[model samples]
Target: MKHLFGNRVIRLLLGNDLLDNIAIWIRNIAVLFLVMDKTGDDPVAVSLITVAEYAPIFLFSMIGGTLADRWEPRRTMMAGGLLSAASVAAIALAVRYGAWETVFLATAVSAIVSQFSQPSSFVIIKRHLKEEQIAAATGLGQSMAAIFLIAGPVIGTAVYARLGIEASLLLVAALFLASTLLVFWLPRVPRETDAERSGGLWSDMREGVRFVLRDARLKTLLLLFALLGIGTGLIQPLDIFIVTDRLALDKEQVQWFYLVSGVGLLGGGVLAAVTAGKTRPNGHWLVAGGLGFLAVSIVVEAWSVWVPVTLVSRFLVGIAMAFMQTALSAMMIRMIDEAYVGRINGTLAPIMTGTLLAGSALAGPLLKATSLLAVFALAAGIVAVAAFCALRLKDRPSAVEAADRA
Candidate 1:
């Protein structure tokens, strides 16, 4: 752990991640409440916020990723941060002019920029960290996410409640600016070779698709991502119903589930970080185990009317999520060539996003058409299929292992 943190690049990357996430959570919550207040709690207006945030991933992720491959990682990240800050500042100004509805543009612009910046982070991770350190780094990063899942909402609510919309928007803009400055300190890394840059954007994208298709491991991971997305999407929208319909509790009580799950995720991430070196090579097994456990948890959550049982199931689900995320990150770093990392990530991401959106779109209709039990059962079944896919993953030598043999 000391060794990992001692690396200057890792420290900078993690610090930037921390700042970025804090800003995002603050922005998301503040914008959401602001919209609610402005629109008198109209559900359609509230839902549009979600659309603005996620719609960009569908539109720009692939292109952004392809560009990340051709661009310098450090510069790409810096550009994204700067662009986000500028857009948010513009939105703040617009809001001040009583055009408050344009606030959705803030979320949309940030989300669009993130698709470009996020893949650059993976490139930096691949370039800076040693093979053995990758898992620990990934785990530590996830730990930060876990922490925020627990505290971010509270912090965002406090800020917005105290400062209100205009201040909150300005604060978000400032945070993005701060993040950009932080990224500016990252050491410059070598750019992609001239040969890599020679291809046109569409050509590069096509190559990325072919690259994933040709790798059996990557292909399997892609399928697993799609299944997990579907499973998660189906259940995510129904959490409140789990409280209201299953546990016979108030919808407001759903917070307890999130709280317990966040706690479990924090513990699981720390455990993964501590054990990463030993477990990195066996990530496929970890992923499989995590998915299997998650599937069971979902099943338990589905049937159990008891509050304690459901809470415990949700907690276990959090732990499973941490382990699966850590394993997936380790696998991506270890398995894929760095040159194709951005393109591959871009390619695989939309499959998951597209499937998740599809599943989310289906969830309400499915629930209305059937029952809560049926919807949960279908989600569990999808995740179980993903677990089975993970089980079928054949172990292969990572670049580090192959190097040692050579």
Candidate 2:
């Protein structure tokens, strides 16, 4: 922990991540509520906010990632931050003029910029951190995200309730600007060589796809990602129902589940960070174990009608998710070549997003057609398959070392 914090690069990156995530949560929650209030609680209007936030992942992630591979990582991230701040500023102005609809643009633009910035962040981590430090760094980074996942909603809602949408937008913009300034403090690194950047954009993208397909480890990881996405998505939109229907409780009581899960995630992330060194070499085992636990937890959670049992299951699920995510991230950084980091992220992210979206789209209809128990069973089944895949993954030489050997 001391060594992790001592690294200036990691410290700066973590700070930037902290601010960025807080701002994102504030923006997302504030916008959703504002839209809800404006549209008289119209479901379609609320859903469009989600579409604006996520559609950019499908459209710009690949392009943004390819660009990150070509551009200087620090500069690319800084640019993304600046662009996000500027977009929010514009949105604030539009809102002041009674153009509340334009608020969606704030979420859309930031999400688009994030597609580029996020890969650049991974590139920087791969370049700057030692292999041994990667796991701790990844764990720490995820821990910050976990913290925000718990606190962000409350903070966003508080800000919106006290200060109104315009002030909340300003606050979000300021957070982005502050994060950009933090990026400015990051050490500048050399850009990719001309030889490395020789391919056309499409060619580079194709190569990235080919690279993942060729690497057995990466191919397996992609499959794992897809399965996890499907499982998580299937249950994500139904948690409220679990409270109201399954537990025979008030819908408002669902917050307890979130709180319990968040606390578990926070603890799990810290555990992952502290044990990262011991666990790094056997990341696949860690991932598998986490997923295996999650599979069981999901089954228990879905099957239980008792509130205490359900909450405990959800808490364990959060812990399992944190461990799995930390292991997966560290393994990717250690296994992939830095040159392909951005493109690989771009390629793999959409698979999960696509699967998640597909599962989410089908979730309601599936529930109406079948039953909650059936949906949860299917989700658990999918995640169990992913765990099995994880068990088959064998640690090998990093991509750079393999290329050199060839």
Candidate lDDT scores, in order, read 0.86, 0.88
Worst 10 residues of 2 by lDDT: 396-405
TM-score of predicted structure 2: 0.96
TM-score of each: 0.94, 0.96
The residue ranges of model 2 lying beyond 4 angstroms of the native Cα positions read: 193-196, 398-401, 404-406
**Most lDDT-accurate candidate:** 2
lDDT of 2 by residue, 1-406 (tens): 8988999999899999989998999999989999999999999999898899889999998888888888899999999999999899889999999999999999899989989999999999888988888878888877888898889999999988998999999999999999999999998767767676667889989988888888888999999989999999999899998898899999999898999989888877887787865764577787887888899999999999998999999989898888777777778777887778889899988988999998898899999999999999999999999998998776556564488547
Pairs that clash in candidate 1: none
